[model samples]
Target: MDKTTIICRCEEISYEEVEEVIEHGGRTFDDVKRLTRCGMGPCQAKICTGLVANIIHEHTALPLSEIPLQRMRMPLSPIKLEILATNSTAFSAVKSVLDEVEIEDGKVR
Candidate 1:
Protein backbone atom coordinates (compact mmCIF):
# COMPACT_ATOMS: atom_id res chain seq x y z
CA MET A 1 0.00 0.00 0.00
CA ASP A 2 1.10 3.52 -0.66
CA LYS A 3 2.45 5.29 2.38
CA THR A 4 0.11 8.22 1.87
CA THR A 5 -2.95 6.02 1.53
CA ILE A 6 -5.50 6.93 4.13
CA ILE A 7 -6.14 4.02 6.47
CA CYS A 8 -8.19 5.49 9.25
CA ARG A 9 -10.21 8.12 7.44
CA CYS A 10 -11.77 9.62 10.49
CA GLU A 11 -8.44 10.31 12.08
CA GLU A 12 -6.68 10.94 8.74
CA ILE A 13 -4.07 8.31 9.51
CA SER A 14 -1.98 7.04 6.61
CA TYR A 15 -0.41 3.72 5.72
CA GLU A 16 3.05 5.08 6.34
CA GLU A 17 2.15 6.05 9.87
CA VAL A 18 0.73 2.61 10.53
CA GLU A 19 3.77 0.91 9.04
CA GLU A 20 6.05 3.07 11.13
CA VAL A 21 4.23 2.02 14.26
CA ILE A 22 4.60 -1.65 13.40
CA GLU A 23 8.26 -1.18 12.63
CA HIS A 24 8.70 0.36 16.05
CA GLY A 25 7.36 -2.78 17.77
CA GLY A 26 3.67 -2.01 17.70
CA ARG A 27 2.08 -5.43 17.32
CA THR A 28 -1.58 -4.84 18.02
CA PHE A 29 -4.30 -2.46 16.89
CA ASP A 30 -4.38 -0.94 20.34
CA ASP A 31 -0.64 -0.44 20.18
CA VAL A 32 -1.03 1.46 16.94
CA LYS A 33 -3.96 3.33 18.46
CA ARG A 34 -1.90 4.48 21.41
CA LEU A 35 0.92 5.56 19.15
CA THR A 36 -0.98 7.05 16.23
CA ARG A 37 -4.62 7.32 17.30
CA CYS A 38 -5.57 5.14 14.37
CA GLY A 39 -8.82 3.60 15.50
CA MET A 40 -10.19 6.10 17.98
CA GLY A 41 -12.09 8.32 15.58
CA PRO A 42 -15.77 9.07 15.40
CA CYS A 43 -16.44 5.86 13.47
CA GLN A 44 -14.13 4.15 15.91
CA ALA A 45 -12.40 1.06 14.61
CA LYS A 46 -15.45 -0.13 12.73
CA ILE A 47 -14.04 1.23 9.48
CA CYS A 48 -10.34 0.50 9.92
CA THR A 49 -10.07 -2.73 11.89
CA GLY A 50 -9.71 -5.10 8.97
CA LEU A 51 -7.38 -2.79 7.07
CA VAL A 52 -5.12 -2.47 10.11
CA ALA A 53 -5.26 -6.21 10.70
CA ASN A 54 -4.13 -6.81 7.16
CA ILE A 55 -1.24 -4.41 7.63
CA ILE A 56 -0.17 -6.20 10.79
CA HIS A 57 -0.43 -9.58 9.10
CA GLU A 58 1.64 -8.45 6.14
CA HIS A 59 4.33 -6.92 8.31
CA THR A 60 4.56 -9.33 11.24
CA ALA A 61 3.37 -12.59 9.64
CA LEU A 62 0.81 -12.83 12.39
CA PRO A 63 -2.31 -14.78 11.57
CA LEU A 64 -5.61 -12.93 11.40
CA SER A 65 -7.01 -14.97 14.27
CA GLU A 66 -3.98 -14.18 16.36
CA ILE A 67 -4.47 -10.43 15.95
CA PRO A 68 -6.29 -8.86 18.82
CA LEU A 69 -9.45 -6.97 17.93
CA GLN A 70 -9.91 -3.36 18.92
CA ARG A 71 -11.61 -2.71 22.23
CA MET A 72 -15.02 -1.39 21.19
CA ARG A 73 -17.29 0.61 23.45
CA MET A 74 -21.04 1.05 23.52
CA PRO A 75 -23.04 4.01 22.16
CA LEU A 76 -21.84 4.57 18.65
CA SER A 77 -23.13 8.13 18.41
CA PRO A 78 -22.37 11.14 20.52
CA ILE A 79 -24.59 11.75 23.51
CA LYS A 80 -25.09 14.93 25.40
CA LEU A 81 -23.58 15.26 28.86
CA GLU A 82 -26.98 16.33 30.06
CA ILE A 83 -28.28 12.92 29.14
CA LEU A 84 -25.71 11.30 31.38
CA ALA A 85 -26.40 13.86 34.06
CA THR A 86 -30.08 13.14 33.94
CA ASN A 87 -29.42 9.58 35.11
CA SER A 88 -32.35 8.48 33.01
CA THR A 89 -32.74 4.88 31.83
CA ALA A 90 -32.30 5.73 28.14
CA PHE A 91 -28.54 5.45 27.90
CA SER A 92 -28.19 2.07 29.53
CA ALA A 93 -25.52 1.08 27.05
CA VAL A 94 -23.38 4.00 28.22
CA LYS A 95 -24.22 3.10 31.79
CA SER A 96 -22.95 -0.40 31.20
CA VAL A 97 -19.60 1.06 30.20
CA LEU A 98 -19.41 3.16 33.35
CA ASP A 99 -20.30 0.10 35.39
CA GLU A 100 -17.50 -1.94 33.79
CA VAL A 101 -14.74 0.61 34.42
CA GLU A 102 -11.85 -0.37 36.67
CA ILE A 103 -11.45 2.46 39.14
CA GLU A 104 -8.48 3.11 41.40
CA ASP A 105 -7.76 6.09 43.62
CA GLY A 106 -11.20 7.42 42.76
CA LYS A 107 -10.21 7.66 39.13
CA VAL A 108 -11.30 5.60 36.17
CA ARG A 109 -8.68 3.44 34.62
Candidate 2:
Protein backbone atom coordinates (compact mmCIF):
# COMPACT_ATOMS: atom_id res chain seq x y z
CA MET A 1 0.00 0.00 0.00
CA ASP A 2 1.07 3.53 -0.68
CA LYS A 3 2.43 5.34 2.33
CA THR A 4 0.25 8.34 1.68
CA THR A 5 -2.81 6.24 1.01
CA ILE A 6 -5.59 7.33 3.32
CA ILE A 7 -6.55 4.64 5.79
CA CYS A 8 -8.99 6.56 7.90
CA ARG A 9 -11.13 8.74 5.71
CA CYS A 10 -12.88 10.48 8.57
CA GLU A 11 -9.64 11.67 10.16
CA GLU A 12 -7.61 11.77 6.95
CA ILE A 13 -4.96 9.54 8.49
CA SER A 14 -2.56 7.80 6.19
CA TYR A 15 -0.76 4.46 6.37
CA GLU A 16 2.55 6.30 6.56
CA GLU A 17 1.43 8.24 9.59
CA VAL A 18 0.39 5.05 11.33
CA GLU A 19 3.71 3.44 10.47
CA GLU A 20 5.57 6.42 11.81
CA VAL A 21 3.70 6.12 15.08
CA ILE A 22 4.65 2.46 15.28
CA GLU A 23 8.26 3.24 14.47
CA HIS A 24 8.19 5.85 17.24
CA GLY A 25 7.20 3.39 19.96
CA GLY A 26 3.51 3.07 19.36
CA ARG A 27 2.78 -0.55 20.21
CA THR A 28 -1.00 -0.60 20.47
CA PHE A 29 -4.12 0.95 19.04
CA ASP A 30 -4.39 3.50 21.80
CA ASP A 31 -0.73 4.38 21.37
CA VAL A 32 -1.27 5.21 17.73
CA LYS A 33 -4.42 7.09 18.69
CA ARG A 34 -2.58 9.31 21.16
CA LEU A 35 0.26 9.96 18.76
CA THR A 36 -1.75 10.48 15.56
CA ARG A 37 -5.47 10.67 16.42
CA CYS A 38 -6.12 7.89 13.97
CA GLY A 39 -9.43 6.70 15.34
CA MET A 40 -10.78 9.72 17.12
CA GLY A 41 -13.02 11.11 14.44
CA PRO A 42 -16.73 11.11 13.64
CA CYS A 43 -16.67 7.41 12.86
CA GLN A 44 -14.93 6.75 16.16
CA ALA A 45 -12.59 4.08 14.89
CA LYS A 46 -15.32 1.97 13.38
CA ILE A 47 -13.56 1.83 10.04
CA CYS A 48 -9.86 2.19 10.62
CA THR A 49 -9.29 0.33 13.85
CA GLY A 50 -9.02 -3.00 12.03
CA LEU A 51 -6.73 -1.55 9.43
CA VAL A 52 -4.56 -0.05 12.12
CA ALA A 53 -4.38 -3.38 13.86
CA ASN A 54 -3.41 -5.05 10.64
CA ILE A 55 -0.61 -2.58 10.12
CA ILE A 56 0.61 -3.09 13.63
CA HIS A 57 0.58 -6.84 13.16
CA GLU A 58 2.47 -6.58 9.88
CA HIS A 59 5.14 -4.33 11.35
CA THR A 60 5.63 -5.99 14.72
CA ALA A 61 4.86 -9.58 13.72
CA LEU A 62 2.66 -9.65 16.76
CA PRO A 63 -0.18 -12.08 16.98
CA LEU A 64 -3.52 -10.62 15.98
CA SER A 65 -4.97 -11.40 19.39
CA GLU A 66 -2.14 -9.58 21.12
CA ILE A 67 -2.91 -6.24 19.52
CA PRO A 68 -5.38 -4.55 21.79
CA LEU A 69 -8.44 -3.00 20.26
CA GLN A 70 -9.48 0.57 20.89
CA ARG A 71 -12.12 0.95 23.53
CA MET A 72 -15.57 2.15 22.51
CA ARG A 73 -16.95 4.82 24.74
CA MET A 74 -20.49 5.91 25.34
CA PRO A 75 -22.70 7.83 22.94
CA LEU A 76 -22.44 5.18 20.27
CA SER A 77 -24.98 7.00 18.15
CA PRO A 78 -24.02 10.21 16.42
CA ILE A 79 -26.22 13.14 17.33
CA LYS A 80 -26.48 15.37 14.33
CA LEU A 81 -26.78 19.11 14.76
CA GLU A 82 -29.59 19.36 12.25
CA ILE A 83 -31.60 16.76 14.11
CA LEU A 84 -30.97 18.43 17.41
CA ALA A 85 -31.92 21.80 15.95
CA THR A 86 -35.30 20.47 14.90
CA ASN A 87 -36.13 19.31 18.38
CA SER A 88 -36.58 22.08 20.86
CA THR A 89 -35.85 19.98 23.91
CA ALA A 90 -32.72 18.42 22.46
CA PHE A 91 -31.60 21.66 20.90
CA SER A 92 -32.06 23.58 24.12
CA ALA A 93 -30.24 20.94 26.11
CA VAL A 94 -27.34 20.89 23.71
CA LYS A 95 -27.33 24.65 23.37
CA SER A 96 -27.19 25.16 27.11
CA VAL A 97 -24.16 22.90 27.41
CA LEU A 98 -22.52 24.43 24.37
CA ASP A 99 -23.04 27.89 25.87
CA GLU A 100 -20.67 27.08 28.69
CA VAL A 101 -18.04 25.61 26.39
CA GLU A 102 -15.86 27.41 23.89
CA ILE A 103 -14.87 25.90 20.56
CA GLU A 104 -12.13 27.40 18.44
CA ASP A 105 -10.63 26.01 15.27
CA GLY A 106 -12.43 22.69 15.89
CA LYS A 107 -10.88 22.22 19.32
CA VAL A 108 -12.83 22.74 22.50
CA ARG A 109 -11.49 25.41 24.78
TM-score of every candidate relative to the true structure: 0.78, 0.71
Question: Clash totals for all models, in order?
Answer: 0, 0
Clashes of 2: 0
| Candidate 2: regions farther than 4 A off | 80-109
Best by lDDT: 1
* Residue 92 in model 1: lDDT: 63
Query: Model 2 reaches what TM-score against the true structure?
Result: 0.71
User: Candidate 1's residue-wise lDDT over 23-83, tens digit each?
Assistant: 9998889999999999887887888999999999999999999999887665666566786
RMSD of each: 3.5, 7.0
